[model samples]
Target: MSSQKASRKAKKKQGGKQRAQRATSNVFSMFDQSQIQEFKEAFTMIDANRDGFVDLDDLKDTYASLGTDPEETILQAFKVLDPDNKGVLHKDYLADMMQTQADRFSRDEVLQMFNISPIDAAGNLDYKSLCYIVTHGQEEEQA
Candidate 1:
């Protein structure tokens, strides 16, 4: 009974981990490692107080250090952020937007370009399919 209970608990933990990974896989998977690192650095810069999230207080502190209040125009620039109207800007959202908007080939575009699965079972790009796409400039259905 004890061993069975332990096995069930382990399975639950693994399932929870998989769910967490799936939840975040689309957050910034469009970016390469270097781009993700750069975004992390930029987020750190904007966070101001070393807190995990960015809010009005962080921006005010940044402007205060510059010896001036932020202009209305400057504030307007951030209005597009916080898409959920959450008031706080999350680092993940910042990275996702940057990757999606700045990339010439967005994730959705790439996924649509191939009839074959672009992503392998491991959730990374299927390099074999990618090479085929690059060489042929079109998808060839696999058997």
Candidate 2:
């Protein structure tokens, strides 16, 4: 084949690159209402005891069923997600966790989060900000 044909083939194989998406403030806003309702239904399934909340055991069960570990990472996440330390994960917090926990922070998101907290221009985050970031969802407004 001629070099020109090979070049065309290479170009076709390269395909188009996707642009990076902006972080949405309201995570559920991206989904259609039916999809959102389905998410709630899935949460209900995870609640196991029908106690209107999911505890660590429920989380472990779901994780195990999905062939993943119910290990430290998830434990720490639950600690962070269950800010009130109620030992039960409710639907609202579940939604907030889905909104906040799972995402790898984009640079813009990091900046936004940092800006909201007690970080100064010199790149120091005070204890309050650190505490806030730990207890509340990353994208949640000042608590």
Best candidate per lDDT, number?
1
Q: Give the Cα error of residue 78 in candidate 1, in Å.
A: 15
Cα lDDT listed for each candidate: 0.60, 0.60
Superposed model 1: Cα runs more than 4 Å off = 1-25, 64-68, 72-143
State each model's C-alpha RMSD to the native. Answer: 21.4, 14.4
How many Å off is the CA of 27 in candidate 1? Answer: 2.8
At residue 100, what lDDT does model 1 achieve? 71
List, residue by residue over 1-143, the lDDT tens digit for candidate 2: 69999998777666432112333256888899999999999998798778888986777678777887645444566566557664445433344445566675555655554555554455444434344454444674587
Q: What TM-score fits each model? A: 0.31, 0.29
Candidate 1 lDDT, 1-143, residue by residue in tens: 99999999999999999999888788677899999999999788879989799987777677677786555433344346634443334433443554577544565655454344355454443333444444345654599
